[model samples]
Target: MRLTIPLLAAALGLCAAPAFAADGKQLYLDNCAACHQPTGKGIDGAFPALAASKVVQGDPKEPIIRVLKGRGGMPAFSTELTDLEIAKVLTYARVTWGNKGKPVQPTQVTALRVGAKGPTVKPALAH
Candidate 1:
């Protein structure tokens, strides 16, 4: 039996597709790890610790925005990373390092990327 071109193309497409979360992890290691650290424990007072971070534990929006636009001390990843890439990194942080928060969806990140005027305010952590 001979493989058709269309069938071959479809198979290649599936094989070449990017795993978003896995890609995001790589991005985090390369771009975010220096400060956030591999274990997600950031340098003291320079970068906030990601483990059980209030920013990551609650709403995914604010953190997603930070990843895209960056914060006071953090560099903006908007020009550095694609929207999908930002979503993946944020999702990885949300779930890693003993943090039990939900994942940040790519669609949610994409929406925020589109509508953000500046950094969106997140709710304060409860005592």
Candidate 2:
């Protein structure tokens, strides 16, 4: 979810960047709500729930990289989503559904985007 500001802007097709996390709700509805659900509880085993997910909280970098690179059944959204949009979506997911990970910053996401090579598969649980 957490993409860099540059990536978010690219996703929105916007060049002008905004300060602070933008509308996370809007970002979710636009991209993830369909699969993740409005409540963040994903379908049974199809798209794992974000609520209290260790993957979501354990290492925010992984999810951000996933969104950027995609894996398995997930399509690569790196081209479609801008960095900022990714950041907002990750921030929203992290805070919602009892997830306690610190909000992902655009910069962190950007770092992952640059460093990550292939799909980032996490363990069943974040340790």
Candidate 3:
């Protein structure tokens, strides 16, 4: 009976997809879907479509850095999100929308953020 429970648990694990405390898909929905749209097609003339976008499909650093720094109309997430959260969302984007791209590791995000260009927070006003 000692081996039975262990074997049963091991077998159950195989049947399930790896779970995360916060799933990548859900993270994308919460953060990106509002602008990008659930379909990833995005709003025309407003938000750019992530679906099959060459940028998203290109280097992982490009998207990761864009998210961290914020380009043009996009707001920066450097302070709002963690490295792992950024990685998960970027990975979800790159892998989804039928775009062929490599997965972005959390370490890569950390590496790119070694010295952020600006202060992470705004200075409080002096009375």
Candidate 4:
């Protein structure tokens, strides 16, 4: 009957909820694993290891800023990831690889995004 159909739809919706939830680890792997490595230990002399990194362990704002504005060689993610995605990925990194930092929230990311400047694009020197 109508009640049975509604109940079934509710059950199906609950089952599909996990699928809609963001997977932070997967996001990190897709975006950061290449440089940070699966284990979070970076390549010596090249990329700095993220495991127990000061930046990761420090205030969430540090990593948020870094992600939005690329450092020496790392690419900025401001254009690539939504605020929620950045928050999730930062939260994942903070909790993993022996790091004990607090989880980052989307609201925090949004605040940082509002105040953060975009990555600097250095102009080429005139010949």
RMSD of each: 9.9, 11.0, 8.2, 9.9
Candidate number that wins on TM-score, 1 or 4: 4
> What lDDT tens digits, residue by residue, belong to model 1 across residues 1-127?
8889999977764443335446668888999999989889999978889988998888888897787777888987766766666767777787678777665656687788777665443322221
**Local error of candidate 1 at 41, Å?**
0.6
Better of 1 and 2 by TM-score: 1
Sorted by TM-score (best first), the order is 3, 4, 1, 2
What lDDT would each prediction earn against the true structure? 0.73, 0.71, 0.74, 0.77
Span of ten consecutive residues with least summed lDDT in model 2: 118-127
What digit string (tens of lDDT, one per residue) describes model 2 on residues 1-127? 7899988867664422232224666877888878889888989879878888898877887899878887667776666666666777787787777777666666677677677665442222111
TM-score of 4: 0.74
Clashes of each: 0, 9, 0, 0
Question: Which wins on lDDT, candidate 1 or candidate 4?
Answer: 4
lDDT of 2 at 61: 78
Model 3: CA > 4 A from native: 1-22, 121-127
lDDT of 4 by residue, 2-114 (tens): 56988997777555334322467888899999999989998999898988998997898989888888788998888888777787788778778888776776778778878
The reply for model 2, stretches above 4 Å from the true place, is 1-22, 118-127
